[model samples]
Target chain A: MVPVFLAQWMKEKRSPYMVLIFISISIAAALLFGSNMDIKLKIDTFRGEGVTVEEAERWIDRLNESGAFIFSLRAEEESLADVRQGRSDMAVRLLKDDYRIIAVMESTNVELVQQHMQAVYHEEFRIMAAASHAEDELEFREAMKTYMEQPPLKLQSSTSSGSELRSYDMRLQLLFGFSLFLAMLTVGFRVNAMTAEKISGIWNRVILSPLTKTEMYLGHLTYSTLIGIVQITMVFLLAKYLFGFSLGHSFGMLAMIVVLYTMTIVAMSMLFTGILRTPEQFGAIFTSIVPIMPLISGAYMPPGTITNDVLLFIGQFLPLQHALDALIGVSIYEQGWTDIYLPLAKLLLMAVIFFGVGINLVERRRL
Target chain B: MLETVELSKSFKGKTVVDGVSLYLDQGESVGLLGPNGAGKSTTISMISSLLAPTHGDVLLRGKSVIKHPQDIRRVLGVVPQEIALYEELSAYENLQFFGRIYKLKKTALESKIQEVLEIVGLRERQKELIKTFSGGMKRRINIAAALLHNPQIVIMDEPTVGIDPQSRNHILDTVRYLNLEKGTTVLYTSHYMEEVEQLCKRMYIMDHGKVIASGTKEELGRILSSEDTILLQLDAYDDAFIEEIRSLDPVRQVERTDQGLKLIIAKQSRVLSSIVQSAERHSVQLINMHVHTPSLEDVFLHLTGRTLRD
Candidate 1:
């Protein structure tokens, strides 16, 4: 078994394929992070009736500090033309009481721009209203100071219940999803070659030794799982450092989920290998499933985002989907182990059962 | 010591191995010879415990290996016909992996790999990937991988098939050394009668899933003891000249030779005069001639009425 493990490890170390996988994922994550970072939350603007350019810039400046919007003042005609040309990401219409946020589509940016605009302007009008009701000169001065200190619209307020620090960071979720997808294909292909080796009589040589069935099976499994874990770690780390994808502050919890998820897919790859005898079958059957697994596993759309019930239902049962859920739950939502253990347990159960059956079938078939 | 008792195997209702019982003593090199599809590999497979016998049992040293296979598995080494190796790995690495699987310690494993690499003559390029090596090089590495464990009994199944003459002889010499100097029990299987004839004291000639004959080279040769072949080298070959020589009295069979005719005749029969007279009558000039002893090929021909290769 040690020979089997060492042999596999040595082969992987000697080959360029793992490096290729890293480079491929790094390129992919780079594209994901780079493109996502370039999104223009900045709205092209104009002075509206009764609203000065100074006031518009003031609101835009406050929203920029919130890391929500980037506003640039333009001529009214030029701003409208930019909006039509899709150059301007959003527009704001300042009215007497409320401000209206506009975009071609109601995207996350649109919602955030609206929230930040409301927060900023809500304070400005509050101070104006306070100045109209001051009792004396000293009182008027005091009122203005009080109104300046207190923001009418509180973006963050103390909730009766605790605020769970959540990460709706799309870039971070793509990091998880893309890494998991590539990991599945990478390890699956490697395991398929291993199955081929088993049938090619090289595996029989090891079997001819004094090793038992369990030891041999475990060796291959452990090696592939270790490979999967390493790949995931590298991809996530690259995303964090190179592309600014954060792990939502729960690095330890995300690490645990990554470990469990790696084991699950490694077992799944073995099961996939055991079901077929040849690479052609893997290419025809298993690889056909590869693209779809990510789709259903939230590698493309993170959990609770897919609109179709049937697709979401399929994702609900997939081990990867639960893994994404658990990953997002702990790292993003600051959910404790108690909150995420069910998903973790499900992933573990899937690993044990799937790997056990896969190992048995492969041993029986080889013998 | 290893022994098989009426071992048989069938696949999909087709019997690839019939009931065959054979044995190898502690230090003897025994050969199992047959043509293609003669079940030689199947029988070897069963004996080495790679495939379970459909019937009967294999015993190592007196205990049934099927009942206590761990004892036999520990000391058994098999050299499969095909080059079973990790093409992506180097020769030293391949040997190291096999040695550790056999549970050799770090120091012993390193030394065994070095020693076996030397035995197969691949020690110079032991670090090169097997895929970069030639076919003959891979074959040598394959043999080297099997010898690292230093097993008591080694079973080689056509280890020299499709190799260059140089590598072929190297492998043959290595097997001889492992058997003679090391006293390792060897169960050698091949269709090449010359290899078996040179290396084995006793042999089993299998044909069509059964052991058709089993005996020493001399003992098997006795099947054709009544006759001997007369070789006549002529200045040139002729068909009708050999035919006329065939009709000569006491010349039982006539076969064309590269330069002349070969006559098979009974011992003590005076056929030299008829063969010489026939060559003179045909205006054929005899270059040289000699009488030769029977070989394993002749024995196979006498018993099966077909050449061992055929």
Candidate 2:
């Protein structure tokens, strides 16, 4: 096993550029995609007949406070034209005491923008109604402002274990998703070298040696898994320290998940190598199939966003889904061992099953 | 010593190798000769334990290798027909890896690699990547890789198939040294009859998945002892003249050659006088006429009616 592993390592040492390129691509892609996650969505806003320009501007300012959706004040004609020309998904028409949404098409963004606007308008209307019963409008306004800042009755959302819930960070999810996705490419290509060796007759020469079949397989797989773990770890460290992305968890937990996820990915790559005939076939199929896993697993969006039963059911079989679940559960939700054991176990089971089936298929086709 | 008993292999009911039985004594160099698709590679694969025979037993020292392949694999070194080294790695690295897998210790492995490199005459270029080498150099390294463990028996399948004469001579010299000086048993296969003639004492000629003949060079040459070959060169000849020559009393077979005609006839027959008379009667010029000695090539042509390269 050591010999076989050393041979693979020597080959990589001679041409280390491929592995370095994969690592660089993983980091570059994560940075490229993660950088866009924080940009606020801009929407055009205009005033109605009962609303003055200053009132509309104030409403726009209030709407921008969440830092999610950006509402910029514009002329009513220009706002309507922006939506009609498809420059914006939706626009806002602020009334004196009511709000209206203008758009040419309905989408998830339109729905989210409308929901946020409704919440703000409902709260303001309730406050106005409460202030109507006061004798002095100015005093009531000042008192309401002070009271809202320091509420006597506060509702804090928490888990059943009494820990505060951490708001989902889409940028972190994108970073993990893109990093894992690219790491799969590196691992899959490394594992596919077995097939390439078989074609080139190197596998037969090794088999003719005194080394057992198990040792040869273990050698190749261990190298692939190690390389994968290293790439993911490097990306995570760079993300946490260099890119200033908050991991929000201990390095030890992240390390454990990286190992398990790398193993599962390596096994998955072996399964793919077994099913395909040639290295070219494996490359084409693996590259085409891997990009869709993050989508089906909801890696680009928050949890519970994918409500389609078929897609959710398919995501259950993918290792990436469980990896993301465990990673996000730890980094964002601050879940402990008990909270993540299921996903971790699922990853281990996948690794075992994939490794077994992959070896069987490879043995069956061995000449 | 090793032997195969009635070894046969089939793929999906199509037999590729059928009932091939051969043996190699200790320190003996034997050659397996055949054309393309003649089951030589298949037989070699079965003997090397790379493939399990459909029906046969390969006995190494009177023990069934099928039941315990490790017995033969430990003592056997196979130089495959393909160049199997890692192209991205240096020659020394390839030898080191193969030697390590054979369980050679580190200190000993380093010396063994250097020794094998010397044997293949590639010690100076040990650090060059395999991809940088020519086809012949690659083949030399391929042989070097198999020799790293110093196995008792070496099986070379077409090791000199496509190479320059210089490399081919070097390889032949290396194989001769391994067999003669080191006393390693060898089972060599090739399309070049002269290579086998130069190296092997005993040879097996196979065709269509069967060994048609096997014996020492003298014994096999005796198969054509009763017959003689005559080469006839003429300035110009017609089919009628060829037919007339074929109809002669001592003629057994007549084949048109590039120059004129070749005839297989009874040994010491007086057919040359009859051929000269026929050529005179047909007004054809006899440019040259010569009697040929029977070689392994002739024996092969007499038995299978095809050249070794066919």
- Which tens-of-lDDT digit does each residue in A1-367 have in candidate 1? 6778888889888985765666467548747664665475667666677887677777657556655457776777776677678886667665444566556777866777766677766765776677667667568867667875896876654312366445466666666677777777777876787677765677778878877867877788788787878888887777678766666667788889988988888888888877887777876887788778767776655346668888877776577778878877766676788899999999999988888887767666742
Candidate 2 chain A weakest lDDT stretch, 10 residues:
A159-168
Candidate 2 Cα misplacement greater than 4 A, ranges:
A47-52, A75-85, A93-100, A125-139, A159-164, B226-291
Could you tell me the interface RMSD of model 2?
Answer: 0.9
What are the per-model DockQ values? 0.54, 0.67
Q: What is the TM-score of each candidate against the true structure?
A: 0.76, 0.90
- Evaluating just chain A, the predictions reach TM-scores of 0.72, 0.93
- Candidate 2 chain B lDDT trough over 10 residues, lowest sum: B293-302
Expressed as tens digits, the lDDT of each residue in B1-310 for candidate 2 is: 8999999999899999999999999999999998889999899989988899999899999999888889988999999998988999999998988899899998999999999999999999999999999889999999998888888999999999889988999999999999999999999999788899999999999988999999999999899899999889989999999889989999987777779887888999998889999999998999999898777877877788777877
